[model samples]
Target: IISVGALAGMFTMMVTMIYSSSRLIYAIGRDGLLPRWFGHVKGHLPENALWTVVLIIAIMGGLVPLTQLVNLVNIGTLIAFALVSIGIIPLRRHQAFNNEGFKVPGYPVTPIISFLFCLLLMTQLSVETWIMSLIWFAFGLVIYFSYGIRHGHVAEKRIE
Candidate 1:
């Protein structure tokens, strides 16, 4: 029963991750950071983006080792968390949002501590993971500069 429950939980988490990732892709595509076809809705779903995500996951599952994939996911999540933690400092300084939301208790200190912990955890990952991450980052930078920068919503807003 315990094993069954664990499997069920893992399955649920995987589904949730796939859904959220597809939504992120859809949002980026809608904002012109990717091809607009991914933003198209079919029966109120971002069908193209959803399928694309599924396809990518399937390919990765088939081609990549499970441990490597897990490491990549861990490092990616850590980096995102670290960036968000550090970003809060600037956002708070700039007063980007109104004071309606829950405030951080220690302000800069809390976020800085969180970012440092994330960095420390990231450093524990394998060297291969770091190499893979750098390659992926480079690919993203290329795409952003070559296409996304010109076609994205921010650029459109600037043109107006």
Candidate 2:
């Protein structure tokens, strides 16, 4: 019963997440984040993004301890959610796209709930995991500031 539900949920979640994540990578690559090859869809999917994700998961699944991997995913996802909540305010005010689509309801409450939920999960992560996340974030910052800032389309538009 419970196990069946859990398995079903896991399958549903994985399929949806992979679909969404690959689409994001496809969009990003289309916007010139990675490479033109990544933007190309194969059989109605972002082939490069899907393959890259599969390769990464396979490597990590083989290498990482199951317990540590769960905690690591939790910490990473929580932090990303928290950042999304915080960053949305600025983006909403200075929107690049006009109100062509539906806007979020309960703006304040929504973001607050999202932030607190992320914070709670983040707090459950181990100190070592936090440290590792910090290191990864620092490296990401370096890459963003170096290559992304210099050559990013948004930055180019800003400069122009």
Candidate 3:
């Protein structure tokens, strides 16, 4: 539907995702949650990983429109956020858990704000976006429950 310099616009958007996502993955690696080698690159040379990310992005973008891709990512991020928020209430309350680092500026309020934000975003999604998001989330949920949930430290803590 978009006719004016669409390729350039989408490429610009893709760069944003690429940069933010790479930094996120690097952070996870630094925290020892993901593979340390991801953060072990020569001054942010997850350069190799970026190539893989670009290849996948090209494949996905080639197959789907930019709008759809954005919506799908939104859905995935929303679900991820929901799961993490759900964790805080129970997990962070434990006396044995480490309580280092910064706390929320306002107890309960910050989470409520975030929940509303996600809900607002979900509301903005189109029908096609909702469907695609459900499909992607379902696939990820299946894998997480089958593999990641069983192996994850957070999951193990929840079980204990």
Candidate 4:
């Protein structure tokens, strides 16, 4: 029973990740970071992007070790959370949200502490994981600067 429950949970997580990643790839393709072929849709579904994501996921699963994959997910999650926490400062200053009723107890200090802790946690991860993440990020930067900056929808609109 426990094994079945764990398998079900893993399946759900995989499905959720696939859907989220496919949507992100679709949006990036739509914005011109990737070939428009990836953005092709059929009946409101990003089928091409979905296939791309699936292929990438399969490749990673086949090539990358399980431990490395776990570290990748952990590091990515921590980085995202830290960035979000740090972003709260600018967001509050800009009055991004209208939440006047309830408030965090520590305010600015809380987010700062959270960001610091995330950094500390990241230091515990393997250097290989960090290097792999950096390589992927650099690749993304290259794509964005090369294709996205020139052909993005926003850039096109700005020029018009």
The reply for model 2, stretches above 4 Å from the true place, is: 93-103, 138-151, 155-160
* lDDT of all predictions: 0.90, 0.76, 0.70, 0.87
Best candidate (score: TM-score): 1
For model 2, residues 44-136, the per-residue Cα lDDT tens digits are: 889998887777777877997877777776787787789989777666666565755756678767887889988987887889888877886
TM per candidate: 0.88, 0.76, 0.60, 0.80
lDDT score for residue 159 of model 1: 18
lDDT of 1 by residue, 1-160 (tens): 9999999987997798799989999999999998898899999999999999999999999999989988988898899999999988877776546756768889889999999999999999999999998998999899989988888886533311
Once model 4 is optimally superposed onto the true structure by TM-score, how far is the C-alpha of residue 71 displaced, in angstroms? 1.1
lDDT per residue for candidate 4 within 1-160, as digits (tens), equals: 9999999987997898899989989988887878898789999999999999899889999999989987887898899889988988776665545768646569989999999999999999999999999998899899888887887776533311
Q: Which stretches of candidate 3 lie over 4 Å from their true place?
A: 1-16, 19-48, 141-159
Comparing 1 with 3 on TM-score, the higher-scoring candidate is: 1
On TM-score, the stronger of 2 and 3 is: 2
Supply the TM-score for candidate 2.
0.76
Best by lDDT: 1
Rank ordering of all candidates by TM-score, starting from the highest: 1, 4, 2, 3
Q: Tens-digit lDDT track for model 3 on 18-98?
A: 887777666655554555555656654676456656777889979998778877887877867866665666666667767
